[model samples]
Target: MTAGILAIDFGGTRTRVGWYSNVLELITREESLSHTEEPINAVIDRIIQLAQKVVPDCEVPSAIGICAPGPQAYTGYIRYAHTLPTWDNIPLAQRISAAFSNAPTFMENDANLAALAEYQFGAAQGADPALYLTVSTGIGGGAIIGGQLFTGWRGLAIEPGHIKFPAKDGKIYSLEALASGTGIGRLAWEKLAASNTPSSLRQIDTVDGKAVGEAAMQGDALALEVITEAGRWLGLGLVAMVHLFNPQVIVIGGSVVNLGELIFAPARQTLAELLIDPLFNHENLLKVAALGDDVCLTGAAIHAQKMLAS
Candidate 1:
């Protein structure tokens, strides 16, 4: 019999389930809408039903692992998830374990799982002490030290997006509030509306990061200005993290990374400018994540394997 572990990647928009053996092979793939408005138990039941359909022949998985949006307990319970409603203080691990009965279940924040995936198989492979940053709808961060997920006391370490950035107005704002995708969109909308910047983006009415990228690529000066501002903020946030951890590698991921050099070039330049030590200025220390979408499932399998070993 082929031994395998079941993995679930639960996001705000969709839920994905798959199985993995030694290599992170996809046995089956199933997705369901993440109904954030519904109660936590209702969402759990939907996920369980979907998992049952995919692995009907398997009696029990070696273990079950979940990657969820968090404020979750380091040990297992979910304290709160911003994307999902009313999930505060829910015993998520216990509920999932009850569903399996025989199999052990484990859960971690999605960003942490992404970091684990990078450490085990992706950009951070062979790099001890690495950091992963996902800059998308919202910014999320995770870190691994000596090949172990560095979840600090109560598992809430490496939340880099929450770090404050000094503003020109003499007040400070969080990286998420200034540089996240949503923040970029809001900034573009406000700036374009307030000024007579002659650009295609202004005609569209609805502004988003994708639109901002497209405009920048098309040589819209205002778009380039806005994106550079976001990149600068992101770099400033990473500077704090780099000083604190001094990780060997930093992996940048998520939808916003699609901006590619438009974002990364400015971010790298700004980071180098802010670093105080000449020792920290180096190439190959930072790179984009290579695993893409399968990262969470891969990390979940790794988490399950660790649980089995423990």
Candidate 2:
């Protein structure tokens, strides 16, 4: 009989649970609002409740995989997560293992899981060494080398967003602080407010990265200018990554990428200009991740299967 695994993708806003046969077949699925403000035990209980509702009478899963936002422990304890306030220093893997009567459990940073999903089954499938980046509210990254998740030293190594970038004003800030979806919005708001440009973005009571992208798409000159600036910063970050890792491919994903070639085209152009090495200038090496939002779920399932096999 094929073994079944339980995979959970726990995010700040939503919790998705799936029972899968191997890593690909979704046997059952469930989702619930994530009460990230609640205590870790409360969240775990909710996940257990959802799992019971979905699986009902089946034997306990062979193993469980969890994907959570991080600064996570190398051993699978959650040190802290920006999205979930109640999860600080929580021994999540241990708690979940106990909940299942000591069934094997594995946990990873959500970005790492997403990267694994792409590496194993999606965009990076055949690439020996690939980088996966998610550019949403914040930028997150993971790397796969020789088909294995490359967690260096503390298992906290692949944080690309924190890389520093020199701003035009000479202040150095993290890539996330300048290039993330939220960051992009902040830049546009600051620039638009300071300028006399008549923009539709001024009509929105609240400024956000999506709004900026939409405004740019609609021919708002200021929005387009800010996004182009953001693209340059993003490309600078990618150049640093390429020089450091020299991966065979880089896969970009996340909601901000929904801006499509508007964002990527400029980013690629900047990357080409900045990467002086001929070997690093290949256009085919950088592409958007094929897997959409489902990557973490798929990745968690894959992690669980690997754990069970080990």
| Predicted candidate 2 versus true structure: per-residue lDDT over 13-60, tens digit per residue | 888988888646888888999887776678878977776665537567
Model 1 has an lDDT value of 0.82
Winning model by lDDT: 2
Candidate 1's displacement at residue 142, Å, is 0.9
Cα deviation at 164, candidate 2, in Å, is: 0.3
Model 1 lowest lDDT segment of ten: 71-80
Screening candidate 1 with a backbone cut-off below 3 angstroms (N, C-alpha, C), the clashing residue pairs are none
My TM-score estimates for the predictions, one after another, are 0.94, 0.95
- Residue 274 of model 1 has an lDDT of 84
The lDDT per prediction is 0.82, 0.83
